[model samples]
Target: MGSHRKPRPSSGPFNGRAVRTVLLAAGAAGVATAVPAHAATGPARAAIVSDSVFSNANRLHHTQTKDSFTVREFGNVRSASVRNQANAASVACSVDDKCRSVALSFQIVTIAGDVHRLKAVNVSDATNKYCDGCQTLAGAYQFVVSTPDPLKLDASARRQLADIERRLDVLTRSTLPATELQTRVDALAGEVNGVLKNAVAKAPKGHDRPDVTLHRRLDGWPGH
Candidate 1:
């Protein structure tokens, strides 16, 4: 028998820029996934992202591409994933490309139907041990997502996590005036307590754990 025909090449330079772009959800539900033992509480619901290619100071020209694949749908929102879904994305001609890939993760604690969260985000397969362009820049973030935690995360999940965590940190720590700050801080405390209560409610009838750790900070990233 003849060999199967090869697939046709892409229309353009694989256009990774289209794939590398970031995506957000309006109101999404996540796939169930297992975290580290210590990470059981405070599942990330948003992502933060940073890459060697991004620079806010110098308007560098770069190509980016992204694709969001819906994994599951809840209410009107669909849980989706993103990553290097395209090829040879856009970027400044002067920019030095150092990283091959990146990834991040996040967790959210809901209080009174509102969400308060934390995250652990990271990037890997960097082109250089250190990237000059993106150094001192914040990493990305995303939801820890309730998906199955395989031994390693796939590209879509990794980048999603990195991007969401990077963004969520800002949302969590956004400063405000003293009066509003106190109000928000108290609101946050209530959210944490809400998560603890939910966990307790689901515990086995006789299970007794005096203390619960609400969040697990992923190491080696900016601002812990």
Candidate 2:
């Protein structure tokens, strides 16, 4: 008798660059906002202000490969979650060797009372790899206003949120250095904060002023 084994699927060498490009394209097309079910005039009224995804990859010949994934969330979040997926494979020959790697990350953000809380989870695994790392960085901004009505984002606030999403799109498609990308992201966040602050200050009297809290997070990367 002879033993038999199933043949493995044939997938060409993993092209990190191509994978990243496809992911970004899909992510850009998938950006959307979920509106609440009930139309109440209290704190129950909430909506997704902004949701976006980002990714990047690098390959050094047949020596090393690296990939990074990021998810950014903003606005009134009712609940949130994050998941990270990673994999790696290597083949060795007498003359040279080949290696492939991949990383994926997901995140969700939610709002509670006057505070926006974000929780994220990440997982990474590799075969024939020396080391792997994942990190999460989060930022939060709370806008407190004196009003009776539930927090209703005005037109300007919505515009700023849209701008933030656009900036993230640019970041993902850009070939700028890591530091430069960070700078652009930070600047956009600042713009959002400034817009929210102005809204809080100009809020009319008598009505319940809505307090806005902006929660930001970058999941699945080194140094968070």
Candidate 3:
């Protein structure tokens, strides 16, 4: 009878721990591939909210208008354009119909009476979208003033002038009554005139001081 050979033992550097580690790495890669890109991130943000007061007015068909004025002063002549424009925002529109917006504006104009021409120097304007209730919008402004000779004012005077202008701007957007609004306008005009008067007094002899004029107007949709 032939003799049987003994079985040879397996040989290599690989062990049971090494095989388990390879299997675990392959399982992790499979899990990562199954997950979606957005799922790995977070949820999206919500939409922005609008102003409640303005939004409510927009839904209703109510309309409102405030007081306005215009003033022109040159040399020794002072003229004004003032009227009651309470119905300025009134229009024939309902909730289903298209409505008009309200607007307020101020401008400074220089008139070349010799050539019958006019040039607008400074302007401040404000507007609100279609709304039924009484609403006031802040003015977006553009200011450009021309002086015969460049104005040179001390720091204190300049600060006072700036403060007056700020007050005038605040009054423009105010919800005050017609008389009150007119009063504030007149006072503000006086303040501006005071500053100009000082500048004119300090000007050198034989030099003509620049004449400043103020113009204000209110515009809205529909007839008033």
In order of listing, the candidates' clash counts read 61, 10, 1
lDDT per residue as tens, model 2, 83-135: 33433332231122322222222222222233233334333332332222212
Pick by lDDT: 2 or 3, better one: 2
RMSD of each: 17.6, 13.3, 35.2
C-alpha lDDT (0 to 100) for residue 131 of candidate 2: 21
Query: TM-scores, in order shown?
Result: 0.23, 0.40, 0.37
The parts of candidate 1 lying over 4 Å away from their true place are 1-103, 107-128, 133-194, 198-207, 220-224
Candidate 3 per-residue lDDT, tens place, 1-224, comes to 12111122221111100100000000122221112322322221111110101111233544332222222112111111112111223233444543333333332221111111223322222233332333323221111122333233456655665676566646654556534554566566556556655654564433344444443332222212
Please write out the lDDT profile of model 1 over residues 1-224, one tens digit for every residue: 11111232222211012122223223223533323423323334533222222221112422221222112111111222322111111112222542111211222211111223333332212121222332111212221223122112245444553443344334333433223432333343334334434543443332223222322211111111
Candidate 2 global TM-score = 0.40
lDDT value, residue 208 of candidate 2:
33
Which candidate has the highest lDDT of all? 2
**Global CA lDDT computed for model 3:** 0.31
| Model 2 misplaced stretches (Cα beyond 4 Å) | 1-38, 42-148, 204-224
| Residue 61, candidate 2: alpha-carbon lDDT | 32
